[model samples]
Target: MKRDRSGHFLMAQNARVLYVPTTKVASSTARLLLAEANGTYRPERLRWTDAPNISVDQGIHNLEVSGLQYFEFLPETQRDHILKSSNWWRVGLLRDPYARLYSVWENRVLLRAPSPWLKNFQHKCSEVLIDGRLDYAASFRKFVNVLRAEPEIFGDDPHFKSQRTHLGGDQVAFTHLFRVDKPGELDIFATQLGQRVGMKIEPRRLNEGLGLKHLDVMDAQTASVVEQIYEDDFDAYGFERVSFPSISPIALASVGETKAINYARDVTARLVQLSQLARYRQRSRYLLAQILRNSGLRRHKKHR
Candidate 1:
C-alpha cells in the first residue's frame, strides 16, 4: 500500500511483478527466469530454508490476512526495506479452473485411488466414484460440495459467509493478474517488468504443453462439463474454449514420446533405485534360508 519513489517509478515504468505460482501453470518456467535474473529468487530455498530474501511460508493470502503484522514478523528494518523496495511487482498466474482441476487429478491419481485418510478428508468429494472410470462431472460436483461444506478452508475469513465476495479484501491481494490463456500478453508483461527492474529478461515459455495428456483424450462432452463447472474461472480469466481436431496418430505419437522422455528422465530414477533395493533384499533372504538349511543338515549328521 505504501509506495516509495522507486516503487512508483517501477510501477509507472513496468510495475513490480509478484508471481503467485498456482499448480499446473507455467510457474516453473517463470521461476527459472526470475532466478536467472535475480540470485535472490530461490523457490526451494524459500520453501525449505527460512531464506531472508523471500518469504515462502506466507503466500499472498497470508500477507493480506495479517498485513503490517505479517511484515513485522521480520525485523523492523526488514519490514521498512520491503515497504521501500523498488521495482517490487506483484503478479500471479491462474488457469482455466477446469483444466487446473483435471491436472490436479492426473498429478495426484495415486493419492486419490486408495482414499488415504488425509486425501479422503481433504478431498473427499473429488474421489472417483467408480474404479477405472474417470467421471469428470461427478468429480467437479464433489469438489464444489467440499468447498461449500467447508467454507472456512476456501473462504476469505472464517467468519465470512461468501468467499467470492470476500476476495481481494485482505485475503487475496495482487497488483496484476495474468490468465494462462493469453501467453503473448505475458511477453509484453515480461518486457515491462524488465524495464521496471532495470534488468533484461527474455520471455521464455510459461505454462504450455502441460495439459497435453488430457488435451487429446478430453472429449467434447467432458470439456463442456468442465466449462460449465469452471465458468467463473473462465469468465474471470477470459478463457475461450479450445476445440481440438480429430486425434491423429502423429499427434498421439508425439504425445507418447514426450511423456516417455519425461518419465525416463524424471520418474525412472527413483523407480530403478527401488527395484534394485527390492532385488537385494530378496537375494539376502534366499542366502539366509540356504545357510539355515546347511546348518540343520550338519546338526542332523552329527546327531546320527
Candidate 2:
C-alpha cells in the first residue's frame, strides 16, 4: 500500500496512539500533540529557520529524528493489535479537498516551498516554473492542468498527493476521525486525546498559508477541474462541493503581490539550500568525531 511506503502513519506505542497524519490538515499540530504525549517532544527541535518546507518543529516528520515510531516498522503482531485492538486510539484528520488543493498551490507554487520532490513537479509541469519565476495564477492553473492529466505519475509527494491514498484505504479503521472544516470536531478530538494521554492537548494552527480564500481564485472551470481531480477525496471524506465565487476568470495576483511572492521564493530557495548543506556538514563532523574516538579507544586497548 502507498501508506506503508509514505510513512504518514505514526505510532506512539507508550500511549497506544496510532496517528495518521495527512499533509495540510493540521498535521504538524497533530504531530506536536502526539510527540508531547509520547514524552518525546524535543525542545531543541523547535528552531528558527527559513527552510520553506521544514516545519517550525523541525524534523518532526522524520521517524528517527522526531523520536516517533513508524507504524510500518512495528512488529507484525503489534501491527495486528493496533488494527484490531479497541484499546489503541487510531486517529485520522481530514480537510475539504478544494481548500487543501489551494493551500498546496499557495505554499508550494506561489510561495515556492522547497522540498526534495519539488524537482519532479518542476521537471514534469514546466509551466508552473515560468522562465525561472513563479507566477501565482499561471502556476496554479498549470498545477491544476497537471492534476487533471496524470497526477499519479509525479504527485507522490505527500503534500499534494491524494488524502485517500494517505489513509491507506479501508484497512485503517480509525477510532477517531476529525474534519478540520467541521465545527468543534478538532476540539472533541483534543479532549479525547487529552484523556487518553493524561495531558492537556490543544491543536494549534501551525503553518498558515497565504491569506487568500480558495473561492477568491476559483472560477467555475477551475472549480470543476478541481472537483474532478479530488472527487475521490470528496466521496471518501464526506466533503461537500463548495460554491465558487461569481467571478469568471478570477483576478490574477496583483503585480506587487507577484513581485513580492517571487522575491520570497528566491530567498527561501537559497536559505533551504544553505540549511541542507549545513546539515550535511554537521553530519560529516559527527562521523569524523566518532571515528577519532573509536581509533583512540582501540589504541588504548592495544596498549593495555
Candidate 3:
C-alpha cells in the first residue's frame, strides 16, 4: 500500500467501466459513483454511528468497505479485455496542477487531516508543520521545497504524488478524461453514468478543507517550484498555467480565519480516530470482517 504503484485502480465489471483515480481530482466522487454502478455501495456497512453519512462518504476510499473491485485483483485475461474492448469506458479525472498542489498543502499539511500517511510527511518535513503554526505562506514554501528535493519520497502517496503516476500513462488508454476544474464536466458525466446504470448518479463532494484561495498562500517562489514539480501534468493535460500576485491582505486575513476553524476540525477528527483505536477488540474484529469481505472469504451481497 505504501509503494509507488499501490493498487488504487478500480473497476465496475457489470457496468463495463474501468476507473483510474487521480488523487485530489474529484476521485472520491468518481469512486462513489462507480460503487453505485457496481451495486456495491453500502453506506450502512461503514457502521460509524456517530456521523453515519460523513463516515460512509469518507469510507468510499476503502475498496473493502466500498465493495468496489480492484482492477489489479482481476485475472490477466479479464484485465486485458477491459483495456482493449471499446465497450469498457475507461475513465480518468484531471485537475489544474497548480490547484492540485495547493490543495495537498491546504488539506494535508495545513488542516492536518487525519491519515496514516500524514505522520510520514510530518517526520520528513517537520519545518512545514512548525512554520505552519504562525506563517502559512512560509510553511507552504517549505513544503514545496521539500517536495522538490524528494518528489517520490512519500512512495507515491496519492495526495502528494503526481496524477501521471496514478493514470498509468499509455497503458490505460483512458476513453473519457474530464477536467474537474471545468464547469459542468462532472454534471455531464453524472448524466451519462446515470443513464448507463439506470438510476440517478450524483457525484458526491467531500473535504472542502479550505476557504482561502491558493493565491492567498502561494508566492512567486512557491509557484515556480510547483510548476517545476508538476510541469508534465500541464503539458499532458493541456491545462493553462496561472499566475499569482505575491501578496493580498484580504486573502491573508481569510487564510488566518480559516486556519483557526480548520485547526479545531482537525483536532476533533484526530480525537475520533483515537477513540476508535481505543476499542482494540472491536476495531480488530471490524478490520477482520472488512478484510474477509474484500478477499471473498466472507459472503457480502452487492448493494443496489
lDDT tens readout by residue for model 3, 39-148: 88877766643321234577787666667788887888988898889899999999888778878877666666555554566666553233234455666677889889
Sort by TM-score, best first: what order? 2, 3, 1
Superposed Cα deviation of residue 66, candidate 1 (Å): 25
- TM-score for each candidate, following the candidate numbering: 0.45, 0.81, 0.78
After TM-score superposition, the amount by which residue 304's alpha carbon in candidate 1 deviates from its true location, in angstroms, is 71
Best-first order by lDDT = 3, 2, 1
lDDT by residue for model 1 (148-187), tens: 4563443322121221221222333456566654557667
Q: Look at candidate 2 and give me any clashing residue pairs.
A: none
Model 3: lDDT to the true structure: 0.73
Residue 230, model 3: Cα distance from true site in angstroms: 1.0
Any residue pairs clashing in model 3, and if so which?
Answer: none
Candidate 3 has a TM-score of: 0.78
Provide the overall lDDT of each model, using Cα atoms, as 2-decimal numbers: 0.44, 0.73, 0.73
Of 1 and 3, the candidate ahead on lDDT is 3
Off by over 4 Å in 3: 1-6, 48-54, 123-135, 150-156, 246-304
